[model samples]
Target: MNDGAPQGWGAQSTDGVRLQKVLANAGVASRRVAEDLIVAGRVRVNGEVVTELGSRIDPENDLVDVDGTAVQLDQSKRYVMLNKPTGVVSSMKDDRGRPDLRRFTQDWDERLYNVGRLDAETSGLLVLTNDGELAHVLAHPSFGVTKVYIAKVDGRVTPQTVQKLVRGVDLEDGPIAADKARLLSASTGSATGREESLVELTLHSGRNRIVRRMMAAVGHPVVELVRRQFGPLHLGTLPAGRARELTKVERGALLTLARSATSSTPAEDAPDTRDGDPSAE
Candidate 1:
């Protein structure tokens, strides 16, 4: 019951590129397949179902989604996931002569910056990109983008401690709480006989040194910490000090999150100052 041409074909603007061509150019699908998708009513332009095969859009200005996933039309944009190794500063440049992020980004010509910070001694799952809007949405605490951290802390952790973390704790800056918390494992050192426990926490706060501060408040200071996930991104098997381009699926998910966050209430204008050394908790 569908034709290649739709009812709005005559009224559409002739100034911009066709929808199918734009989708095809963005690697969403081949031109023919894109047309089929449009005719099938699976493609939306700016939140409206657009099935007219001849519909034109400003790829740079208009938002498009195919099958509920965001279509990134700008080819110049870059999204990278880095498993940051401990001891390297999160900054792109360090004036103190410490190891920085330059080595991982030298291959790309685009100037990129870390989305959020991981303290110098902590490691894992840092996103680097030139996409400022996406970075703001993911990094700002007001947006509540959850991050998963696995912390190795001193002393044996128990259910009570986990419950307290979930209930909340008061810190110097303010009260904070983990959205989710659990004890992964606990062991006693063979030589030193000191107890250690691995605690996995899910939090949406961007406070500096938040994980360390939280554990210390509960009588178990963090000895080591690593972020395992950021929003929809997972560290997975990515080795430390390595970087890779995000897969098409990953980028689509990330963009979709950013779009959703932007559509909600506007976040505070304060800069995420947690990017500094001894910060990014």
Candidate 2:
């Protein structure tokens, strides 16, 4: 299960690390959840159930199983940045025959999942990775990872609306607010003075279709939305549907962001469950 040598193993020791940490780093679940699994006797090492939370395991020489499923680190973890195009689903696979990212990542040998997701209508910087720990860290709102988006809306974005968005809007699930908002450009809409403009927004909430819902809540429905940045990684000039590996600097910044998370459990402000759409993720 380790990508090749089991993630984080080469840097540590073959004597193994805590079983819970190994499971967490491998992306089986979060460290806290992994502890729960161990306590519940759902995890095993070398054919013996290990209920101790602090048990160590040599991933190279030992076999780990969770509920009868073998677990290993992905030796070749991938951290990819894709300038996703519109009409492409967030997942690498599309079950309903709809367009997805498969066409954009057909050449990659290892199966990679989108870090978060960008619904078919939303496009921009989407990270793909096989590194379970990195993915979990990035997706966890406890990290407070900020993402930027450029939204083309039906009418001129108003300062009052921006303030409301920043102050926090009550979504169906809970309240969410923007970290920042700026008017990029404004012009006449398809109709006369109806107006249209591109507004830049940054937020960390991962609620489903949050941006669209937020804009519509303020009476300015979105026409087009493109993510400009995810954490410190910017989409830059990559063409639509194109993909590239993360540069060294970008990778470092992201790892830093992930490690900066304050806790293993979701923050109180985080949604109770993850919604596949990464509109504000």
Candidate 3:
């Protein structure tokens, strides 16, 4: 046996290791956070902005930077995708002793941080990694990383309801709205003499409990909610609670998309904070 020694992040296995892992090793942030910084257009490799979470870099010759500062990478970095189950908090550990992501990641033996968190009652795709810089922007609102969710609500949802959600909802914190919303297959079923419909929501906001609150405001309380997609990654048949590494194709497509996004939108498109930016912490 080869003693199961893990390969280093940049061992030239295939297109170098994931960019997030390199940032994580450089002490920039955990892999998840690293993805956020990249997606927020904060990190640069070889003097180009890289927003693609799936992008890779050659640590030997490439230059890496975060918010205009260079990063020195180390050896170990891990990226994992976990199909989060219900009743578990998104954090690595739960002080209240409730179910957490750690229970599902024991075998990997890596300190992976959750990328975009899902509430305990909600379940679906969850990304865990040692890259903290990427995780920051993916979760931040300014980056506008689209996250898609499907929710089963407690009423006969109508097109009018859908329109309202797409328009906007005034929440306690502030006004919020989904970028897109649609009613899935309308199945007529008998349950309490009322119809329960499935609605799909796509939004960029990362506010707390935003999805559940949005539906409730429109008179359709969410009975069940599950995240189906995040950016370029989808929760395809990976089985609930199971974890897997990103495929090569998936990684490449994401980088290509992020790079395109950066090129399309000029820096002036960002808000008044376009000038001197605060450090991404």
Candidate 4:
């Protein structure tokens, strides 16, 4: 974790830089871009250019020059949140040749990346920030920032399904379960009057395809899933694809929730995992 030494250097508190942060601090570009530099062999440490993404460097004494120029680390930090719509990937840049969120961030001076991921088919609140430390903690599985999602399932939900979810259902990720799951509302199909239900799911674990997979485990495959909240931050009134920065209060809420995680934590004013709420426009 010490960023100051790069082989043959004394250990010192030089504000160690994650290889990506070092690249970003060096003005090479955003942290994501810096990662690419580490991958491409363009970054030199001491007299040798390192191409490894896992390397760390101290800001002082560590001779890191990118592309033949000495990089001056910038000190300011930036944070942003997007009500990510479906079709947008949660990457800083995409190699799959699809539209990326960067286009929306062109107006900002600092580089940023998604703090946590949202699936290409899922939509809702996503935090984007340049504060690497904050992003690292929020997404860290041990910190356990709760994520709330509203899922539209394929058929009427059985009461057993809700109980199983609350009680915990086994998933490939291991005994995957919701911190809470409840039926918000159920309705007969509008045209066929067939059974369909809206269920709310909340959990602190971040696993690939978690919500969809959980519903499927209970015989109710998800037709659509939308995240409504992450920790104390909410998508409240933020329209799909739109974005807003975290307010002072909202940011404080996140930090407090992260530091004081336990049972009986209060929910923010954001929506929960309940179905039947009108879709956001």
Candidate 5:
């Protein structure tokens, strides 16, 4: 007869025990995985292995281990944003001779990488960070971090195109659309009067070549795409080829946005504001 007492439940028991958190306290894995372990009937509290969802453990008293590995919550966090320029590759390293964003920040000691990619041809605000959890939140599709783009398309465009884009259009990837779009202006220079359409599009989904594809889908075919803003951050007057670190306040705002993304909650009610002050460069 082989009887292995459950893991967290020891001779001493605490008044309150949460099965998943107990596993997390023991370093079994992340909270999500710990819940899974409990569901799988791999967790034992006080000689009795349990698969209950509501199990808890007093970290001060409970003995816990997950498949023998100890898991602990992460402490230190880091965040950074870069005003990416054209010709800079988004990857950490490229086998090709192209320059990566890392080349620009050789002096930074802290480990950081692009939170999201900006294709070699695309330019403007790009976020970089060392906080893995934050990065995960920004990269996930559910976050819906809005990205605003200023695009110049060939030929003149009618207002109907703007309406169609805002209404949503079917793409190969199913129905994808811009949250909002508008014709900023239609202009032509010199005596030739060769005109171009300047349009702004705001979308929360960060799909590959989404902005370009959407424009093309509408037959406008973007000739130039510049990301003007990302969520609460904007490129502002920052010219190309310059990079800056996010200010403490800006960083806090970003963190709040990321938290809101995960919680599926709207941002706390506050006045819509931008550029309280430029933090630093």
Candidate 6:
């Protein structure tokens, strides 16, 4: 691996920004500390270990990594996690005058859109971001970003049912299956006198109303549903209807996941199905 700076480091470049300055501006470290990091061979530019001083790069075009984590060079990029409440649509604006995502995102100046839809009735970890490339890769079904959902469904869900979910079932659209499934708990409704089961399902499909449809196919219709996890993101204890910016660590992990997906599969080959009806679930 080339550990030295690229050629022309001594030349005055109109387009390139100084490497340490870029790292300092990106909040990686102070300029002095960034220089130390570079000298220690901890920084990489375009997958090359760039250790020599006075290195310059195009912040807009170059890929940088610190300690193996991808760094976000653009300061304008925003990542927010919203615990969407039921009855709110995934879109910024609803054409039929229904509740939309604007209420949760009005505070940010950067225009953000949900990475994928959770439908009007389903709620939980919805990612809102202005990073178009990352969003496209994450929401595409072909990328297979795993999502976890907890569903309160009618009737008791059995182990056999879970096995069936894992084994795959024939849906109207096509065959579908859960990556994993488990029955969390079962209880009887006090007023309605009906048995209901709380089941957790992990799936990589971006199909619309998938959990509900899958449960129904197995004879246990979903009464309520909420996504608990998406890729490396978890809803945690964030209250319903509230949104928060992703912490630096969380951002790094998320960016890494996006980078890994795109690196393996070019984004152009996979159609962006996030806005499709199937992604709404």
Ranking by lDDT: 1, 6, 2, 3, 4, 5
Assess each prediction's global lDDT (C-alpha) against the native.
0.87, 0.73, 0.70, 0.68, 0.65, 0.84
What are the models' TM-scores? 0.93, 0.67, 0.67, 0.64, 0.65, 0.90
Off by over 4 Å in 6: 1-15, 268-278
Please give the TM-score that candidate 1 achieves against the real structure.
0.93
lDDT of 1: 0.87
lDDT string for model 4 (251-278, tens) is 5565445334422243233211111011
- Find the number of clashing residue pairs for candidate 3: 22
How much is the lDDT of residue 259 in candidate 1?
A: 87
Better of 4 and 5 by lDDT: 4
Off by over 4 Å in 2: 1-75, 190-193, 262-281
lDDT of 5 by residue, 1-281 (tens): 01234344433544466667655553446889877887886765433566767655555434333443222223233455576777777767677978887765665677666666777778888777666656666555556778889988876778999999999988897888789999998777345467778999998775678888888888888777888887788888877877767764566567556654655643333221111111111
Residue 251, candidate 2: alpha-carbon lDDT:
63
Clashes of each: 0, 10, 22, 7, 15, 1
Off by over 4 Å in 5: 1-76, 189-193, 265-281
Q: Could you give candidate 3's per-residue lDDT for residues 112-214 as a string of tens digits?
A: 6777678888988877766444454445466677889999888788899899999898988788889999999555556666678999999887677888999
Whose lDDT is greatest here? 1
lDDT per residue as tens, model 1, 131-202: 877888888888889999999999999999999999999999989999999999999967669999999999
| Clash pairs, model 1 backbone | none
The worst-scoring run of ten residues by lDDT in candidate 4 lies at 272-281
Q: What TM-score, to 2 decimals, does candidate 4 have?
A: 0.64
